[model samples]
Target: MQFIDTHAHLDVEEFAEDLPEVIIRAKEAGVAKIFLPAVDLPSVSTVLQVCRDYPNYTFPMIGLQPEEVKGDYQEVLKKMKKILDASFAQSSPFIAIGEVGLDFYWSREFEQEQLIVFEEMVKWAVEYQLPLMIHCRKAQNELLHILKKYKHDLVGGVFHCFTGNQNEAAEYLKFDNFVLGIGGVLTFKSSHLREDLPACVPLERIVLETDSPYMAPTPHRGKRNESAFVANVLRQLAASYQVSEEIVASITNQNVARIFGISV
Candidate 1:
C-alpha cells in the first residue's frame, strides 16, 4: 500500500545532514510522495532544491506562513511569486499555495498582516488554478470568512492539522472540494481528534500529512517528525475508522490526488 505525506517540510535544515536517508526510509515505509510547503522567502530555494533533487518523489509550494508574517511580508511575497512564475515557465508549476493561513494561537500582533497576506496568497491560487494547503490556529472562523468570498474562484485545498470539532469539520465539508488533513495529533492520548475525526469526517474528505520535523505521532511524540512516521498517523486513522491500514492509505492517496491533481 502506498501513502502520500500531503504536507511536509522535507526541505528544511532539520533534514540537511541526511536527507537522502530520510527519503530512503520514507520509501521503505511506503511514502511515495512528500509535498514541501515553503514558510518564507528563504525556504523557496530550499524547497525548490530538494524537490528538484527528488523529482516526483518530492514537490514544492510557495507561500508565507501566517505566523511568519510581519514587516517586509510584501517584499517576501513578491519574490516568492516571481520565483513561482519563473519556475512554472521552466518546468511544471507548483501544486498549491500553502502551509499558509491564519494563526492566532500565539498572539494577535500580526492578525491584520496575516489576513492580508493570506488573502493575497488565496488570490494567487485562484489566479493560477492551484490548490491551497491551509494552516489555521484559533482562527478558523476568520479563515472561513475570507474563503467565503472566493466561493467560486478557489479550486480546493487541505485544511492542514485540523483539530476542530464536528461542527467545524462540517463547515469545511460544506466546501465540497476541501479536505481535512489529519496528522500526528490524532495519536496523542489527550487528543479528541481520533474519536472526533472518525465520526466527524467521511473517508473521502480526509487526507494524510506529517507536517514533518513536527507533529510526530505517538511513540515518536516529542521527537523530530519524518515522512516515514506518517505511517503511524495512517495506522491511527485506520484504527479510528475500524479499517485496515492499506485501505486508509489507498483512499487518502486517492483524495490527495483529487485535491492536487497529481496521481501517485
Candidate 2:
C-alpha cells in the first residue's frame, strides 16, 4: 500500500537534526514520495536542498505561505518567481506552485495583500502549467471568490489542510480540477472532516497528507508530524468509506499521481 504525503514541510527546523530518519521511516511505512511545499522565500532553498538530498523520494513546490505575506509581498513574489523562472529555463522546474492561498485566522491586516499575491501565484501556476497547492484558514469565502474569478486560468490543485463544511467542500469540488487534501485533521476527535468528507466527497477526489512537523495524527497529535504518519490518515479515511486501508491507499495514490503528474 504505497502512498504520498501530499503536503509536508520536511525542511522545517523541527526536523533539522533527524530528517534522515524521518524519510527512512516514511519509506519503511510505504510512503513513495513526500511533497514539500515552500512557505516563504527562504523555504525555496530549504525545500530544494531536501529534495536534492532525496531526489527520487522528495519533490518541491515554490510559493509564499499566506501567513508570511506581508507588506513586502511584492518583493517576496519577485524572488520566488525568479527562482521558478530560472529553474524552468534550466530544465529543472518545480512540480507545483503552492502552499499558497489566504489565511485570516490570525489577522486580516494583510487581506488585500494576500489576495493580490494569491492571484499572482495563481497566474504562476497557469503560466507553468503546474497544479496549485492551496492553504486556507478563515478566509474560505474570500478564497473561493478569487478562485472562481480565475477558474478558467487554473490547472487544478489541492485544498491542503482542508477544514471546510459539506457545502464548502461541495463548492470546491465544482472546479473539477481540484481535490481535498486530507491530513491529521481527519484523525482529530473533534474534526468535522470525519463526517463531512465521507458524506460529501468521493474517495477519488481526495489525496492523503500529513502536513509534517505540524498536524501529526492522533497518538502523535501535538507532536512533530512526519511523512510516515500519513498512514494514519489513510486508515481513518478507509474507515470513513468502510473500506480497507489498502483500497484507500490505492485510490489516493492514483489521485495524487493524476493531480501532481507523479507516479508512486
Candidate 3:
C-alpha cells in the first residue's frame, strides 16, 4: 500500500547524520511522498536543500512555525516573505504555506505577536491561492476563530497533529477547507483520538503524517519518528475504522494529494 507523510521535519538536525538511510527506509515502507514543513528562517535553507536533493520523494512547504515566533519575529517574517517571494518569482516547487498557527503551550508572552504573524501568513496563503499547514497547541479555539474569519480566503489546508475533541473536528469540517492530520498520537492506547476521531471525522477527510523526529507511534513510542513509521499509523487507523490497511492507505493518500497537490 502506498502512503504519504503530509508533515515531517526530515531536514531537522535529528536526521542530519543518516537522512539517506531514513529515506531508503521510508521508500521500503511504502511512503511515496513526504512533505517537509519549514519551522523558521534558519531551517528553510536546509528544508529546501533536502527537497532539492530528493525531488522524487520530498515536497516542500514554506511557513514560520509559531514556536519559532520570537521578539524578532518581524525580521523572521521579512526573511520568510523574501524566501516566498523568490520562490514565486523563480517558480519554485513549494506546495503550501504551512506548519503555521498559534501555540500557547510554550510561552504566552508572544501570543499577540504569534497571532499577527499567523494572520499575515494566512493572508499570504490567500494571495498565493495555496493551502496552509497549521500547528495548534492549547489554542485550538483561537485558531478556529481565526480560521473561521479567513475560511473564505484560504484555498484549503491541514491541522497538523490534530488532537481536538469531536466539536473541534466538526468545526474543521464546516469549512471543508482542511483535513485532520492523524499521526502517532492516534496509535497511543490512552489517546483520546482512538475513541473520538473515528466517530467524528470521516476517513476521507483525514490525512496521514508522521511529524518525524517526533511523535513516533506506539511500540516505537518515545523514539525519534520517521516517515517509515507511518505504516503503524495506517494499521491503527484501519483497525479503528474496521477497514483494510490498503483502503486506509489509499484514502488517506488521496486526501493528502487533494489537499496539498502532491502525488504518491
For model 2, residues 1-264, the per-residue Cα lDDT tens digits are 798999899998999999999999999999999999999999999999999999978999999999999999999998888889899999864888899999999899999999999989988988888999999999888888888877887788999988889998998899866999999989999998888888989999999999888888997998889999998999999998899999998888889878888989
Best by lDDT: 2
Extract clashing residue pairs from model 2: none
lDDT order of candidates, best first?
2, 1, 3
lDDT per residue for candidate 1 within 1-264, as digits (tens), equals 899998889888799898999999999999999999989888878888998899989988888999999988889888988887887788655888977999999899999999999999999899888899999999989999999999688889999998889999999887868999998999999999888888878889999999999999999999999999999999999999999998998899889888898777
**lDDT of each model, Cα atoms only?**
0.90, 0.90, 0.89
Clashes of 2: 0
- Specify the poorest-scoring 10-residue window by lDDT in model 2: 90-99
A best-first ranking of the candidates according to their TM-score comes to 2, 3, 1
RMSD of every candidate to native, in Å, equals 1.1, 0.9, 1.0
